[model samples]
Target: MTVAVLFALFTVLLIVGVPIAFAMGLSAVTVVLMFMNVPLVLLPQRFFSSLDSFPLMAIPLFILAGNLMNVSGITAAIVRFASALIGHIRGGLAQVNIATSLMFSGISGSAAADVAAVGSMLLPAMKKEGYKPEWSAVITAASAILGPILPPSLLMVLYGAMTGQSIGTLFLAGILPGLVIALFLMALTWWKADTIGGQKHSRATKAEIGRAFLAALPALVLPVLIIGGIQSGVFTATEAGVLAVVYALLYGFVTGKLGPGLAWHHLRDAAIATSSILIILGGAALFSWIIAREGFPAQIAEALTTLTSNPYLALGLIVVALLILGMFVETISALILVTPMLAPIGAAYGIDPIHFAIVTIISVLLGSITPPVAIILILACRIGGVDYAKVIRPFIPYFLIILAGLVVITYVPAVTLAVPRLFAGYGG
Candidate 1:
């Protein structure tokens, strides 16, 4: 009864267009007042405790680091390096789009940031080079999904804080899966190059390549500094985030890209972004507590196991559900609302939490490109001056490519776990 009311009211609030955080808080409070005997004070208390986590400090720090890098002109350097290596391919600019996102993903772990930073720069160039606006926007949106799947990912940090899993292990686990998605996008770009009709550049000379690499080398070393430090036990994920900020600031100053005025502006922007995410998190945490108190996780686990004892089949169902949910809910909101419910079910079926974490994060990310709530896609389209409807047709093939990659990551544990095993001697 409590479970039904909880979801029923929550769904109603969503349909009525209440903000996600408010809907979660209101639904949880209503469920408590009417169905459970729990004190109302628990709601606010749980909300506060949820935001009190030290691991969560990584989200804002990573956000700030990514922003600092963007303001410091690191993104242009990475793009130049990627172009030198692959800009002569059939779909040269398209390939560069994928490669730059892959490189940028290491620094900025937000898909929206990826689209804004890379898409804004590349979209106009692609259009001027004879590529259709829709194709340019579609490719930009598709490649940006790589942002959250790479190491130093904000999504991975949030998943770790919520599930009590090792953030370092999760970061390590993300490497291959992120690369797999990038490869798929690149393959699709290569095959569709002639159809898309983009300008191709001359192959970069050794001198040009060397120069670009030299320019990007400092930015390229950030992921190593972060992942290496974490894997070597030199810092926790939260401390690594602090280091990332310090590194970004130092690099900015050394390069003369960030002056005091620019630094202050970026810092202010980061704080605003951080505040938005933390509020959603706090509300979701309270909702999570209410669900847990009602034994929802155990019920969900029992129900799923009864439906199918096979872990693969169970995961397939979850993938389908997440894809659908992704179309409606914001990714982080969906993660907070669903992870607590699904993690237990995965465990019951003998799935490793880290493996499940990788799958879950990717699934929600797919939502960022899908319709109705395709925030990243919308941003790309707006930037490219293309209609959202026009981009949909071109987006279908890229979407399938990413979906296939997600399936491979889901079924082949090694794709997600090998790096973690190699680095930490733990395979999840």
Candidate 2:
């Protein structure tokens, strides 16, 4: 009854256009007041308790690092390097868009930052260079999702925080899966070159390729620094986030790119972004507490026993339900609401936590590029000045390839588990 009221009220709030964070908080509060005997103080206590974790500090640190990188001009250097490697190919800009996202993902760990950073530079250039604006928008949005699938992922960090998994192991787990998505997207770009409408560039000479790589080298080293430091016990994930910020600042100083006023603006922007995520984190924490208090996970597990005792079917059903739920709720909000419930259920069925985490993050992230609440797609269209309707047709092939990738990562646990198991001793 409590779960029913909580979900029903949350659905109503969402349909009526309340912001997700507030919606979560309000629904949880209403359910508690009406059904539970706990005092109202539990609300604020749970909310702050969620934010009080030391590991959670990585959230804002990463956001600030990404912001600093943008203001310091690392994004363009990465794009230049991507262009040199693949700009001669058919659908060159689209290929470069994917490549740039692969590299940028290592730094930002966010699809929004990737789309904004890479799209801001490449989208206009692709449009001016004769690529259809709609195609440009579709490709940019598609590749941007790699940000979270790669190491240093903001999504993975949150998942680890919520689920009590090792964040370093989770970071390791993302590497191969991230590469697979980037490679497949590049292949799809080549196959769809004719439809994408971009001109090919002359292949760069070896010297040009070396120079571009040199230019982007500093930016490229961030992921290695983070993963190496974490795996070697040199730092916690939170400390690694500190290192990322320090590195970005050092690069800015050496390049003379970041200045006082610019730094202030970027810092302010990062703070605003961080505040939004933290609020959502807080609200979801309260909601999760209420649900757990009701023994929801056991009920869900018991209910699933009737549906099927087969773990594979259980996992499949969860994925499909998440896919549908994602089409409506924003990815992070949906992740927070469900992960606290589903993760334990996954363990109850004997799924590996790392594999489950990867599958769950990637599955929810698809929402960012999908409809009704396609945040990444909307950002891409807005950046390129293309109408959203124009990109829907162009988006279909990329979406299908993404779905195929998700299916592989879902059923074939090795696809995501190999690196973490090898390096971080995961599942041992």
Candidate number of the best TM-score: 1
Question: Model 2: runs farther than 4 Å from truth?
Answer: none
Reference-based TM-score of each model: 0.98, 0.98
Candidate 1 — what's its lDDT? Answer: 0.90
For candidate 1, the 10 contiguous residues with the lowest summed lDDT are: 35-44
lDDT of 2 by residue, 212-233 (tens): 9999998899999999999999
Native-vs-model 2 lDDT? Answer: 0.89
Off by over 4 Å in 1: none
> Model 1, 175-214: lDDT tens per residue?
9999999999999999999888788799999999999999
lDDT of 2 at 100: 96
